[model samples]
Target: MKKLTSIIVLSMAVAATETVNAQTVQKRYEENPFTLVYDGAITRNEKGKVNIHPITYQLNGITIAANIYTPANYEVSKKYPAVVVAHPNGGVKEQTAGLYAQKLAEAGYITIAADAAYQGASSGEPRHTDKPANRVEDIHGMADFIAQYKGVDANRLGVLGICGGGGYTLKAAQSDKRFKAVATLSMFNSGEVRRNGFQNSQLDTVQERLKQASDARSQEAAGGKIRYAGVASITDEEIARTPTDLYREGFVYYYRTYAHPNSSFLYPMSSLLDLMTWDATTNIDLINQPLLMMAGSKADTKYMTDEAFNKAKNAKNKELFLIEGATHIQTYWKPEYVSQAVNKLVSFYQNNL
Candidate 1:
């Protein structure tokens, strides 16, 4: 009985530690004036220094909440290269996307990161609809707004998409010529994963899942209760038991270390009707712009980036960069890994844009 008591005590202590750590992270976000969650986020916009501006605009009649970052010594009268950053699936602008945007701005470029429609701070009904078309449109919408922003040189525009955003970015860049240079980090093919399952683990359930998704759409059309897919919340125990490194680390990053109220993993079940039928690599040859794709060498999701990059036959000066000994989530916030990525990004943008 003494041994059992010791084990229980240890478990409780570990849980308590996790809770305190999560609270510390949450406190950081709540303290920021802009609700910026990333490390070193701007607390105030100052002249002659990198600044962040929270702005909103209409995209397909939906209000898109975005943060635009300007480099030090920015001037409205001078032309500057710009980059539109698309967030990962289930991520908001205040997370890794915002971190990257701020870093790019520090590197002497203007950058904007926006929440996807029906997600984060953006306005859309039947929230968290993860449609491929809508996500691709969000990237295009960013380009539309940033291209016209003061001091922006539209001709030198570039794009950086992370995770699921990376997949959508490929699709958007296929037709959106406004983006002169294209890049992706830890590209996740939502369609392929939703249809085939992570690592094809659910290939046997493909037809069954498709049927369920169809039924969900039908119910929605008939004004029935909306069904949602994915985890709305997860406990520490569940997170520890999650099998894949991609998912396990992702949960820790999104839900614990960088938790944001506006960020969630849920999506309308009906969204699978579109998501399962779409792919990021379709007509990938359409991307004729300079392309730079980066992924962690140790990430399980690296396969998706590899697959997409292989199909990008027509991308001008295409390159795939791998950060040594990094995982999918590490690229988001690990100081060393992030530094490596930001350095590479600055060099790529300078050379291409």
Candidate 2:
């Protein structure tokens, strides 16, 4: 019995050492010299002649971290149009969302990008909870907070959601008329993909997957270990063998060139319970504001944008613009595509807001 106890103690010490090494070796902005790490990032802030204000506020009892970008020569007393930019799943406010906010602010608008609760520097228990309802509420919270910001013209507010956030923006805009214009870039329908599988590839295993999710939930309720799903890590050979450009390129974007420590495409396994029951296209026609949907012409996930755009039947003015010769992930960072999308967004918000 004494020998058995000693063996267990030694095993636990080894396990703890491994966990510490994993934490220490994770990626950071310092690894990439070109990484724009903070809000109102120093180098670009000067180049763009804009300012980024890092702020925090309470949302539903949780502290939310965000960045608000003000246009050059901003004046608190003067009325200015504002936009709320929502980040993609597994993405933080400081990444592509911040890039767009900075660009839009340079175009003479006040913009904000925020981390979702339970993710990316935000405070919440059971970290990485990716529920649809919580994401929608985050958008509303942004609107509520920004509408009251000094110099903002609440009457002329707009919204731009990227990837999964795009789907939630559609749902939020349906009832949140405070958003005068709504737009999406590379829109990905989380619920549709979760329920039926990406590109409808998991139709046969729906019940099997649901059972797994149910079992995970039961485990958590009984005080067992929390189970997570999605890509925690990937190898070069696996990415090379990936069948779709969307995921293959996405792996490069998230895990290599633009990697960040907090950015991960994971969610609790039990999240599938709510995710499988939700669809981003349902009631999409309820969006009464002007809508603009943009997707890369070659994006494998373009079908999601196409479906949602077609269903936004009641939008006051709707336009579908395609960026030629770019894939879904490329739109997030490639220079030409980013410029093209930003130019279109500027014009849309100018005309509508």
lDDT of each: 0.94, 0.88
Residues 7-44 of candidate 2 have per-residue lDDT tens digits of 78877876675465444434336542324543334454
lDDT of 2: 0.88
RMSD in Å for model 2: 7.1
As for candidate 1, its clashing pairs are none
Off by over 4 Å in 1: 1-11
Kindly give the number of clashing pairs for every candidate.
0, 0
CA lDDT for candidate 1: 0.94
Residue pairs with clashing backbones, model 2: none
